[model samples]
Target: MYSKFLILLLLSAFCTSCGSKPETTRPVTGTITESVYASGVIKGENQYQVYSTVNGLVEKVLVSEGDLVKKGTPVIQLVGKVAMLNTENAGLAAAYSRISANGERLSELENNISLARQKMNNDASLFERQKNLWDQKIGTRLEYEQRELAYSNAVNAFETAKLRYNEALKQLRFQEQQSQKNLQILQTSAKDYIIKSESEGQVYDILKKAGEMVTPQTAIAIIGDASRFLIELQIDEYDIAKIKIGQKILVNMDSYRGTTFEAKVSRVIPYMNERSKSFTIEAVFVKAPQTLYPNLTCEANIVISHKEKALTIPRDYLLDGGYVLLQKEKKQKVSTGLMDYQRVEILGGLKGDENLIKPQ
Candidate 1:
């Protein structure tokens, strides 16, 4: 009978221990932060791909990857035999068409004009002398008429010579101007064969080799500012509305593992990326890493709001639809506020001293 009583006692104890005894904890006063998550890459300021304006075989690459360059620096030289020949031909044409080159021809025209004027003056004198002789009754009528006709012919010849000289001078000037303009254009075009950097920066990549063919459409190199860098992030569409310029951002980069960097949003691209279904935004580093390079992958969290002291509980303890389990398996609804990955803010229905049961 004592053994039976002992066995009953053990069974009762086992059943009692197995009965539901839920774990519980009270809410604590702490800080809570709400933020949006993003992921993107690092880009140097003013980064851009370099392209040549004309088509040619690359004869030499003047700048290598990681070379520092100034604005208007020569980056590549192209094989421009045809361009050189065209320029030379244009120069020769310009030289031959110069007004000074036709000095001898103009001199001949001037000489003819002078001769015509002298003959015209001589004819006028003879005609006057003949008229005087006829008036004095010492010359025949035929002689007077002949002298008048000769004077008229000499005047016409003089005018014709002057007209021819003026026309020749005008033609020469026009040709000179036209040829000079053509030479200037060809000279500018020849300079296009030497590709130059458009901005002051460092060359990050040289995309083409010395023997590769390049056209205006081909990018020959990549360049950007050497010292300045920015973070480019794509924020999901659901959280895009929370993003704003000047918001604080916490950045983590793969290159700098375990280190968090602070940055601020500088720009928000107003357009959405159709493929990614995300909005693109840019941020400038406030506390930058010692060394940074272009195209570094990074993850970021943009802080939207924060509270230093709030009644908060672990996210797992809170049930869906804003309810929490209390003692005796009772459910009570709670008004919530700002939340993060691990915690949720309880604004109402739960005091800091109440024990909340973990839901099974």
Candidate 2:
């Protein structure tokens, strides 16, 4: 009986100790800044992947990885033997389509025109002589009439020959023009085989080496503005609505340890990434470092709002979404406002002297 009594006494003592234990803090006026976190890579302004435009062996690479180049400067050259052959063939076709005296077809037409003209002149002279004879009654009427008919037929033949000659010439000219246009197209395609920079910038990398087979889809190199840079960040969709252009950002990078950089949002890409469920954003440095390279990973905290002094409490002290633990284990409902990752603002039902317990 004495042992049972001792066990009951110990149980009661344990329950009392559990009820008496307390961890508490009073609501205080303090600052809170709401920010959205993002991760991104540092990239040069206008940075882009350069691609080859023809399928061939890379004959040469004119620029190195770090070479600064101007727009339209040649960066890579392909073998282009096929393109060159095609262009030359087109040029020859254009040149040959132009008809000249040496062309048998054209010579035939010229001969017909000359022969018809000679016949016309002869018939006209004969008709004139015959008409004069008929007028003086020295020639038969039948003979004069036949001569006039011959003259008229000869004139018609001459006119027809001239028209045929002109049409043939016109056809030849049309053919020549078509050939010339085809040659121009071929030449342009051949020129494309020599990959050129689209913008003035430094080459970040050369993906294809000399003698490597490359196609139009193959990346030849990367280039971008060497003196300027911008940040490409991916922000969570949940936080993107609050992100706006011109908002200040606090940037941190592994490359620059123990340092933070200032930046501002320059653009917000509205499209969401299907894979990451995030939106892409662009920012420019307010005071960039002395130097930066392309593709450097960085982290940023986009400032959404800030309060100078507000009724705040440690985030850990809150109980669930709408309440806090009060004295004597009573649940107190407090109206909450802006919150950071570590603290929450109490809009109502909490005061500076009232104790809010941190649940253990």
The lDDT values for all models are: 0.94, 0.92
By summed lDDT, which 10 consecutive residues of candidate 2 come out lowest? 98-107
Each model's TM-score?
0.77, 0.87
Q: What's the residue-level lDDT of 84 in candidate 2?
A: 93
Candidate 2's C-alpha runs over 4 A off are 1-20, 99-111, 124-145, 319-321, 328-330
Model 1 misplaced stretches (Cα beyond 4 Å): 1-29, 128-149, 236-241, 269-279, 310-360
The clash numbers for all candidates, in the given order, read: 0, 0
**CA displacement after TM-score superposition, residue 357 of candidate 1 (Å):** 9.8
Instruction: Give me candidate 2's TM-score against the actual structure.
Output: 0.87
Compose the digit string of candidate 1's lDDT tens values, residues 162-192: 9999999999999999999999998989999
- Model 1 C-alpha lDDT versus the unseen true structure: 0.94
Model 2, residue 290: distance off in Å is 1.6
Give the top-scoring candidate (lDDT).
Answer: 1
